[model samples]
Target: MLLGYFSLFASGFIAATLLPASSEVLLLALAQQGYKPLWLWLAATCGNTLGSCVNWYLGKELLRFQHKRWFPISQAQLAKAEIQFNRYGSWSLLLAWLPIVGDPLTLVAGTLRVRFGLFLLLVTLGKGARYALLLFLARQLW
Candidate 1:
């Protein structure tokens, strides 16, 4: 029981990082094992949300190296992202829980200098809602 939540927290953390990890399967298995759903949901949500915060901080720090040759994104790409951000607005942060665009959205929010309070609020809401939905749906399957 203790091990399960710990593993889920680790998995959730890694998944939110640039690293490839997914806690969904482990979460589902544990749910079937009769662990309390609310506790499991909170574990995954908090861990994942904290992980996204790491990515957000990394994105914020990347601005320091924007002029360096080794910087990962090109000026053109950054400009394009800026254009998209301008059009889409910060509400796109809600999609931060999604894959592919989700992680990048969090990074972009940081690079764009989004307000930290708003960033945390949006990220928490999005991630928390996702876990809540998953818990709700998973329970129906049993």
Candidate 2:
């Protein structure tokens, strides 16, 4: 039981970050191993959101310290992301599930000082919907 929870958390965290982890793989593995789907979904969602929040916090800190020189990110890129984030607002987080761009979007949201409450709400909705869709597809295909 504990192992299952740990796996879900790890999967969620890695999925939210720039790493190439797959939460669906872990989810399906756990489900095939007899874990409860509802609990797994909740755990995965909470862990993913927390991981995304970590990225947001890092973005805030980066802006605070002006650490662009040390990081690979350039000011021009950040500026473009900022403009898009500003135009889209928290709804931009809807793309939080997209590959490659999702992680950066979270950071941009924080850098833009998007409302924390709205950020959480949008991230939850986007991430939750993503996992739910994956679950449905898994059921249909597997």
Candidate 3:
């Protein structure tokens, strides 16, 4: 049981980050093993959200560091991200479900000092909807 929970949490965390992991696999495995779907969904969502928060913190720190020499990111990229961030604000987080750009979008939100409550709300909604959709598809396909 503990292993199952850890698997759920770890998969969730990795999924929220830039890493390429599939929490769906974990969910399917757990479900096949007879775990509760509701619990699995909640655990994965919460854990993934927390992991994304870590990325947000890293983005905040990256903005503060501003050491172009040490960091590989170019100033132009940062500036562009800032411009988009300024224009879109937290709403950009809706794209948090997209591939590649999704993880960085969360980081940009923190770098721009977006409101935490709004960030959480949008991230949760986007991520939750994504997982829910995935679950639905899995149910349909399986």
Candidate 4:
């Protein structure tokens, strides 16, 4: 019932974060169990988008702590990330649904001070399309 959808949403949210998770698998499992595909898609998309927003916020905040001994990344590494992100520009947010590099891209967007509205729009489009395609494939296969 609602719990299933909430679980999917939570999974999506966690998956989009730096934390390791896979909302896609949960989504497909729910689809197999006969939950409405459209609702699943919506839940997953919103959750994941919100999660990326959190990453963006963290990216903005991290700059303040880059010189701290507890900061996780080295200055060079941060600069490299900034360079890569700048090379790609804000359009890279459109790939926020990707596996390895996706989460970091969202983070970089915030560090670069990308507009929140644009970040949300691109992230939503990328994440929603991914979930939609997964659901479509689930329907076709099962």
Best by lDDT: 4
Tell me the spans in candidate 3 whose CA falls farther than 4 Å from its real position: none
TM, every model: 0.95, 0.88, 0.87, 0.95
- Evaluated at residue 90, the lDDT of candidate 4 is 82
Query: How big is the positional error of residue 10 in model 4, measured in Å on the Cα after superposition?
Result: 0.4
Model 4: residues with Cα > 4 Å off, grouped in runs: none
Candidates by lDDT, descending order: 4, 1, 2, 3
lDDT by residue (19-121, candidate 4, tens digit) is 9888998999999999999999999999999999999999888899877899889978878988998898888888999999999899889888899999999
Of the two candidates 3 and 4, the one with more favorable TM-score, higher being better, is 4
Q: After best superposition, candidate 1 residue 93: deviation in angstroms?
A: 1.2
Winner of 1 and 2 under lDDT: 1
Task: For residues 1-142, write the lDDT of model 1, one tens digit per residue.
Answer: 8889988888888888888778889888999899889889888988888888888899899989989999889989999988997787888887788987777788888888899899899888998898889888999988
